[model samples]
Target chain A: MKSEKQLVELSLKDDKHFAELVERYEAKLSRYIFHLSSLDSASTEDILQEVFIKVYENLNGYDTSFSFSSWIYRITHNEVISFFRKKKARPQAISPDDVDEDYITLIPDDTDIPKELKRKELAAKVKKAVLELPEKYRDVLVLRYLEDKSYQEISDILKISINNASVLVNRAKEKLKSKLTI
Target chain B: MSKLADKILKKVKKANIKHKPRWQFIAKRIFIWSALIVAIILLSMSVSMIIHQMTVAKPVFSEHFQKREFSPIFKLVPYFWTLISLLLLTFAYFDFKQTKTGHRHRPTIIVASGILVGIIIAAVMVSVRAPHNMEEQLQRHPLYQKMHFDKDFSKGPGALRPLMKSQANNPLAFPKN
Candidate 1:
């Protein structure tokens, strides 16, 4: 990887700079995206790339005082929310008739004969549970726990006050804790 | 300074839209240029219209206008309107051509369709109603004299018509004779 100064120098003009920004952010952003939803790493990468694309296009309108990262993150968060909403609108996945024993084996350890049960379902589980939270609270949790953004950073990203962000995050944690415990 | 910021920033740097196809750049240029051109045209026409109004009306100094036969261009509203309609359609056509893609943008398409439909509806309504209006206006032509004198000039006191009285039993009053 190039030095930050070198990369910034190369990219400040526009698109190429944006590409550089992507190259710099993809891995971590992908992880963040993954946490935002239970998407596979590849899907996460794709979404992360998309978020950057939006950022690049909207950069001209972006105020210099606001952190670019925050702006991009908000866009990314919005995109993920929209994605889930779209997914919800679609007909849900039906369980296959011939449940492969091998497929079940691939998923992490679980108990006895479970034809009615799901496999892995970690991503699905977290998605549904997290999504059940109110939009603001849900966003705070997704950014804080899943994306691990600081309150200040999340506030900047979300265009919200830091205190509000903190309150939301704590509320989100409680919500998640309750859902996960059950 | 922290690893998280460092990490997020790193991703941010890599995520810009340079990787997007070349056509997108062309699209941006086209939008910018076309919007600018339309904006310039609109501005120029507006200014020209304003100037024409000022010259024709001499609004600011009534004395300057009194000597001139500066009847307002407002009387030619219909003609001006037709011209504006034509210009709008032409602009819409160009915009449609410019914004056209293999797959049309639904919002833009709907908006264009709406404008076209609205214009057509208005034109039809005007065409349908215009003859009646023309006839009515022509009928009222000699009204300058017809309405100027009272029906019975012999009656000095400006008596309103009998229809102006309420149709109650006595109306207002009745003499025995």
Candidate 2:
């Protein structure tokens, strides 16, 4: 498989190659769109098309220094923000998912099967708490935990400083812990 | 291939918007930064002017400074300029957050620090401008001569009685210069 940079270079030359880039990111980006906003599958799909169009428009100016994923996520972040503003609506809560394997250990680290079951319940609670967080804190929490992004990547995507990203994550964890204990 | 990808690919083929030059984005960021700098400088200047006015009204080293008990100059502070400076700084603050990478630091801390730095610079500017005695300037003006207002008048009407009684008792209320 070609590296992201290679795809970017190839996509610039041949329009067909851009489809590959879109296909590569489509599922992840769609999931991200759903996680980040209140958009349903239909609306999410519509916005995904818009995001890809924008990504294509700016491909030539894309700086190679940053990770392509961060850049694409940044664009998606902006698109969702604009979408909310246009609709004059607050983001709705995300549904529960089984993507909490990484956080399962944090639950208790007991027997594998029962701990897994407990972890899933805790994960659902955490996700619900995350949805209740203020937009800023929620964003960092989602990017940090759900997306498994580093502070630097979160910073790049959200256009915040690494220090701020760290602060937000710490604060978000505290909020989530408080929520779970209740 | 996802439906979104297929639709987006069709739109890309049909729209074909070219990439904007890198320099344009760079130029926009540069402009935002420059504007923020200019706003800070203006804020500092306004603060300096306020400090200058206060310093002129009361020279700290002068033994003769009677520290007017009720001078109208106290009410004449440049509050308007202070408000303008604050508003300009706020504008700069929002503009800064919009700039690339501006959101990394906490907004309150950066703005507060920027204001503190502006004030420090303004204080330095006031020191460099040197002290001018506003009271002395007012005394030397042609209007003061024409009006024949008593020098003690600036100190309030109640103050005149004490000075009159002292002058009558000592013959020289203030010693010969």
Candidate 3:
């Protein structure tokens, strides 16, 4: 398996290599787009296509100093923002049902509901709370928790300082906990 | 291959979309960096001009203050140059923000550093008397001369001192000597 940078170099030379690159990131980016936007599957696919096309077009612009994943994520982040801007609409919250159960554990909650039924209820509430956060906080929380990105990676993707990334995550968590309590 | 990837590939092939040539990206990066450097240089020059104006006008300003002449003191302040410096600083800030990692810095840090760097460069320019040379060059321009010479010291006590001194030596006034 070629490293991502090698793949990028190869992709520049041949469309076939670009296919491999696309395959590698397709599912991950699709999921990311789905999580970040309130778009339907068709719109998600449309946005994904635009993202890949942009990625392909700007291949030469990618800097070697940053990881390819972060760079790609950053592009996807921008594309999604552009999508929102073009529509002149605020990003609606993600549906709670679409959130994975594993992500529910990531939300910082001190409450220990004993029953599975109550736990599921709390999970739905937490998911809704996470999704409904102000865009800045929600974006950081989703990238940090759902995407499992490090603060440094989140910083690069969001074009924020590492210190700011961590600060946003902490604030997001605090906001989530307060929402849950309320 | 994933269906989405295949579809994208087919679309890319159909549309004949190609990676933008490497030089274009390089040119873009160079343009942004060049813009940032130019903004900094301009900012430095503006700051140096302000410093030059202040130093040159300080004595005149003090004299006017002592004489309770408010008009020349106000004219001596480098308001125009200060405004130009501020505008250049803003341009420098935005240019720095366009750099790859510029967003990683806080606005306060970027602005503070820009100001600090501008001051340091301006200080160096002042040390080499660059601002004085620039002022001399500017003085030759008719418009600069008109605006600067007329508003600055043309009617002030300093400009009148020669006339005042020359009159005191007139033979008609001191015929005994």
Residues A9-37 of candidate 3: C-alpha lDDT, one tens digit per residue: 99888878888998899889988886676
> Candidate 3 docking: what grade?
medium
lDDT of 1 by residue, A103-180 (tens): 232122332233554554544554555656677876777677656678777877776656678777777766765665
The CA lDDT at A58 in model 3 is 92
Candidate number with the higher DockQ (1 or 3):
3
Worst 10 residues of 3 chain B by lDDT: B168-177
Query: Between the candidate structures 1 and 3, which one is better when assessed by lDDT?
Result: 3
Cα deviation of A99, candidate 1, in Å: 22
Which CAPRI level is candidate 2?
acceptable
Task: Write down the DockQ of candidate 2.
Answer: 0.38
lDDT by residue (tens digit), candidate 2, B1-177: 656667777776677666566688788778889998888888887777557545533432132345553443333344545676789889878888876667767888779977897899887766665212332243365553343222243455333222223333322122223
TM-score of each: 0.39, 0.69, 0.83
lDDT of each: 0.50, 0.68, 0.79
- Order by TM-score, highest first: 3, 2, 1
Once fitted onto the true fold, the runs of candidate 3 whose alpha carbons sit more than 4 angstroms away are: A89-96, A110-120, B62-75, B140-177
Compare the candidates by lDDT and give the number of the best one: 3
Real A-B contacts recovered, model 2: 0.64
- Look at candidate 1 and tell me the lDDT of residue A68: 57
* Chain A accuracy as TM-score for every candidate: 0.65, 0.82, 0.89
lDDT of 1 at B52: 31
